[model samples]
Target: MAVTYLMLARLPEGGLGAFDAYESAVLPLLAEYGGRLERRLRTLDDRVEAHLISFPNSEDLAAYRADPRRSAAAPLLESSGAAVELLAVRDI
Candidate 1:
């Protein structure tokens, strides 16, 4: 069973920079966990700022979530006040 994880993020004010930094450091770590950057940076609207990322499976997604690198990046994301919405879907 292959699962997909979709992450939707709403960056806080002055958070894009922090998000960028986090992404730079965490992206590779994600790959190490069997996750691929299906969508790195995506712009939702000109006025609103948000991003969507997809992972290959739940295992990879979980690995990314539990990774120490991700832990390190947590503060930056928190400081940026980024809102994260996660959805996990198993392939039918």
Candidate 2:
């Protein structure tokens, strides 16, 4: 079954630049894994960032997570100290 993910991140202190870099690096990788972004949003008040993505299946999601480029960009998340919450769902 197809899967959907709601990725919520707590932006880092100097969040914009790092977040921007993270976005640039990761977004395209999703497509390679048979996934696409459905919606992306961020709130000014809490600076909570969210992205809604759909994938063909769990395997696609796993591959996306394992992508080398994505793994390299992983450091941006670490240095920025962003908290992340990933929620996965699917149509009933």
Candidate 3:
């Protein structure tokens, strides 16, 4: 299995709204491509949010990353003013 962690920093101004839409709309679409959200959290101290997504393997992760739904949601996320930092890990 493989896991991808996304640390998201919402853009100033409309961050919360954007993050909400992303969680409601975009994250669900990832499941259709074999991705599952393992964890999600909002950090008060750092003023950022984080998501941990898992896939069966690298191929599945790739599929999720390349999915049209993900692509479609990009603009909405951008409009909402959000940026993501991604980290990937492979299970032993």
Candidate 4:
């Protein structure tokens, strides 16, 4: 079954640059796993970023999560002091 996820990222004030770099590098990898980034949003203050993403199935989502490139980019997110939350969602 197709899967959708809501990802919320809380970024540190001083680490916005790192967060941007991290996302720029990693977000593209989703496509390799049959995933799409449906929507991406950010608060005016740049404190929070929200992503609406979908994958062909849960396995695809897991594969994306374990992608080597994404794992390599983890330090960037960690260094940015970003807190991330991911939730599975269903359309109404």
Higher-scoring candidate on lDDT, 1 or 4 = 4
TM-score of 1: 0.74
Off by over 4 Å in 4: none
- From the highest TM-score down, the ranking of the candidates is 4, 2, 3, 1
- Which structure is stronger by lDDT: 2 or 3? 2
In the range 12-60, model 2's lDDT, one tens digit per residue, is 5677678778888889888888999999998876468898899999899
Query: Model 2: residues >4 Å from true position, as ranges?
Result: 90-92
Candidate 3: give its CA RMSD in angstroms: 2.6
Query: Which 10-residue window in model 4 sums to the lowest lDDT?
Result: 11-20
Prediction 2 global C-alpha lDDT? 0.85
Candidate 4's residue-wise lDDT over 17-89, tens digit each?
9999999989989999999999999999999999999999999999889899999999999999999999999
Worst 10-residue lDDT window, candidate 1 = 45-54
Every candidate's lDDT: 0.66, 0.85, 0.70, 0.94
lDDT of 3: 0.70
The reply for model 1, stretches above 4 Å from the true place, is 44-56, 90-92
Candidate 1 lDDT over 3-82, as tens digits, reads 55666678756777777777677777866766655654557541234333455656667777888878977888777767
TM-score of the candidate numbered 3? 0.76
Off by over 4 Å in 3: 4-6, 90-92
Candidate 3: 10-residue stretch with minimal lDDT: 5-14
Best by TM-score: 4
Residues 2-60, candidate 3: write the lDDT tens digits: 55655556455556776677667777777777778887888664357777777767787
